[model samples]
Target: MQLVAPLNSSLRRVPPGWVYLAGLIPLAWVIWLTVSGGIGIDPVKEIEHRLGKIALWFLIGGLAITPLRRIAGLNLIRYRRAVGLIAFFYIVLHMLAWIILDMGLLWEQAVRDLIKRSYLYFGMTGAVLLLPLALTSNNASVRRLGRNWRRLHWLVYPAVGFGVLHYLWQMKVITPEGWLWAGVFAGLMALRFRPFRG
Candidate 1:
């Protein structure tokens, strides 16, 4: 607890803007890798997968903030919005990679894929859930919506669930990574119950 105090204090000294700027590094690196032919044979699929996985990572990170603060006495509340918006940005990029590179701007094919693919359906559902949350992430929206804003952002839990399910369903066989994320999601959700609250 003593060591955690200094760490938390140090983290508090860092600006949220710095974190937001740092968050763009992953996207930039992925773009650079794609341009430099460094993303392996199937660059398009790699790009899409990388972006989607990063988005899920950020989503999970954002979800972990509250639990981290409550259980570990670490405070990072200031960066939660930035983390969530970064996740949304990656999600958009992931969809764009699929639509532009994978589907080649073919709406009919994309729509067909959306209809036939359960993973796509789950991913799309997660995207739709995130849309409003992203739109209302600003301070103006918080002021405008008042208490409703909190209720609206609660959608993140379901959005993350769908995102995880999309990832799990996309794999032909469940990997350790899939189980790890599922366990993390389950643990985070469990922590939200009254018994776990401190």
Candidate 2:
């Protein structure tokens, strides 16, 4: 195993709230751009791109919990719920953009696109999967669901796969950046299997 770089003694002792606050940098930047007209009024591509990126970031965040906790020795358990909820937040916004801006709430056309477009179908599946996971994220649900909570959350892995595939299929040329994230995802997922788990 690789040695984890030690955080500052201060950082190791910081409160969980501060850890979450530290994680808000990217979200804050996105919001600033959205509000400052830097992203523009009719910025469909920019908006969609940012939404997809943020969704992927959240997906990475959710996936990182176990690795960070176990491998990095980072005590990331507290961040799991926060990271998961943030993922749900980005996903809801992504869906809202598609429904409100792209499709204009056109149910017939949306249904047609879902049926005809494989990438769109993959994206829709990812979004739909997020709903139940988001709903059951609370402490009450966790207490009630017990071990089954984890079983249900396993859907996030496939959701991430579908999300990346949705993007990769849509891209005219899959860039190094795309491949890098996919590689990271593959490594993370590989860790979940028996051989790599060691």
Candidate 3:
């Protein structure tokens, strides 16, 4: 525990590696379980679900940085890009899983799901928005676009909304857990206003 404290300070200054490391452990664990047959039933769906949730959690966590730093006095800004990129990466995986595993690369099925299922459409919309953000995240693109890059990145808020809506719409019963996620996202969105953050 003492060792981790110092590590945490170092991570705060340069957190991309740490963020990847932090996320990799759970991702690797999931892969391991799937390979080892420890996941019991429907391993593919279980893995897909877990990855998607983790991705969404990262997205929310990335969004929470500004509020946490302002309200809670945590310097979470350094990790924001890493968190966002990882969130994008995981969402890509989740999308691929749906496309290849669930839809089996069937264009008709994918189109049908997007058109018919509100949840899928929401998720797909969120994923689509992330593409531009991810592409322009690097130093080169940042320099190339200047202020325009920031404008594009601000789309994250709506993307997050789409993600949360996707989760809520996916759940048949709208459990307390789903409500909690939505509530947190609501709080995050609200915090964007100075009055609320203060």
Best prediction by lDDT: 1
Candidate 2 local lDDT, 1-198, one digit each (tens): 233434534355667677557556766777788788888767766777788788888888789889776766766676677777777777777777777778889999878867777888888888788788989988899999999999999999998888888878778899999899889889899888888664
Give the winner by lDDT: 1 or 2: 1
lDDT of 1 by residue, 1-198 (tens): 788889988997899999899999998999899898899999888999999999999999999999998998889899999999999999999999999999999999999988888899899999999999999999999999999999999999999999999999999999998999999999999999999899
RMSD of each: 0.9, 2.8, 2.9
Give TM-scores for every candidate, taking all chains together and pairing residue i with residue i.
0.97, 0.84, 0.90
Local accuracy of candidate 3 as per-residue lDDT tens digits, 1-198: 445457658756774787778878768887899889997698768877888998998999999988876765666677889899999988988888788888889999889878888798889889888899999989999999999999999999999999999989999899999999999999889889877756
Error of 2 at 87 (Å): 0.9
Evaluate all candidate structures by whole-model CA lDDT and list the values in order. 0.95, 0.79, 0.86
Between prediction 1 and prediction 3, the one with superior TM-score is 1
Model 2 regions lying over 4 Å from their true place: 1-28, 40-42
Instruction: Report model 2's TM-score to 2 decimal places.
Output: 0.84
Pitting candidate 2 against candidate 3, the one with the higher lDDT is: 3
Instruction: Evaluate residue 13 in candidate 1 and report its C-alpha lDDT on the 0 to 100 scale.
Output: 86
